[model samples]
Target: CVGGSNGGVKIEVVDQGIGIPQDDLPRIFEEFVQLEEADQRGTGLGLPISRRLAKLLGGTLEAESLPGVGSTFCLSLPAAHPTG
Candidate 1:
């Protein structure tokens, strides 16, 4: 179940916890975005920072979820170019 085309170990975060709501999902990655039901504990900066970091590292981060089901986040890095 674990395989990669990149040289670096991809870090995946999967959670079935109260999957993000359709409308909320899009804004969750924005700065200052937070869920009041979550006690507003979310700073909303976390995702943004993570995305920025991934971009800086030449990687991509994606998220998908189903309400009341679960969520899957993939942080994929570029495959290491083999050096002779």
Candidate 2:
């Protein structure tokens, strides 16, 4: 889902896969950090890199999840302004 909010763009991505634990949410954005229970093998740089890129673009990336339900990721970018 994508829409406008607070004079900016709010994009949300939702997944039905295994949700992340509240305790691990903050660590997930760290470099080379992966959950022990994760099934896939990865270097764990994805979220960290993504967040850095979003920050460079003047945006923010965040997540919310429930133990058994799912997860939601939101990327919010500032609205574009026309240059004279």
Candidate 3:
């Protein structure tokens, strides 16, 4: 209302875990992407799929990280206006 534009909903996820490596940053949004040598097990399509769905809904999915510090992921979605 202030800017004559709708403000979207914001979603943020942060982890104090080991964080991410510099190299894997690029492919994090790609399908079948994972931190190589990661001792875990999974298809690694989660983020890619999430990003796709967000895009379809006029939203955005993104992430940020600091090697040994932590990481944060955010999702923004258009708000649904109420109908009288």
Candidate 4:
């Protein structure tokens, strides 16, 4: 889902896949940090890169999950203004 408010835009990516454990949620944004419970193998650089890009753009990348239920990743950015 995506929406925009007066200050910024918010985008949420939700998945019904196996959810992450609360203890490990924060590690997902770390470089090359892959969870053993993952269904497939990955290099684990995606989230880290995504977070860095978000920060560079003056935005934020975050996540929330419940084990065995699902996960949600949210990206929020400030409203952009046109410059002459």
Instruction: Give the top-scoring candidate (TM-score).
Output: 4
CA lDDT of every candidate:
0.76, 0.87, 0.80, 0.90
Model 1 pairs in collision? 6-79
Worst 10 residues of 1 by lDDT: 1-10
Q: Give the count of colliding residue pairs in each prediction.
A: 1, 0, 0, 0
Winner on lDDT between 1 and 2 is 2
Output the lDDT of residue 71, model 4. 99
Which 10-residue span in candidate 2 carries the lowest summed lDDT?
1-10
TM-scores of the candidates in the order shown: 0.75, 0.82, 0.81, 0.86
* Candidate 4 residue pairs that clash: none
Model 1 RMSD in angstroms:
3.3
Off by over 4 Å in 1: 1-3, 6-8, 80-84
What lDDT does candidate 4 reach at residue 41?
82
* Count of backbone collisions within predicted model 2: 0
lDDT of 4 by residue, 1-84 (tens): 343577798999999988999999999999999889557889999999999998898888999999999999999888988899
lDDT of 3 at 1: 10
Q: How far is 30's C-alpha from truth in model 4 (Å)?
A: 0.2
- Give the poorly placed runs of model 3, Cα more than 4 Å off: 1-5, 81-84
By lDDT, the best candidate is 4
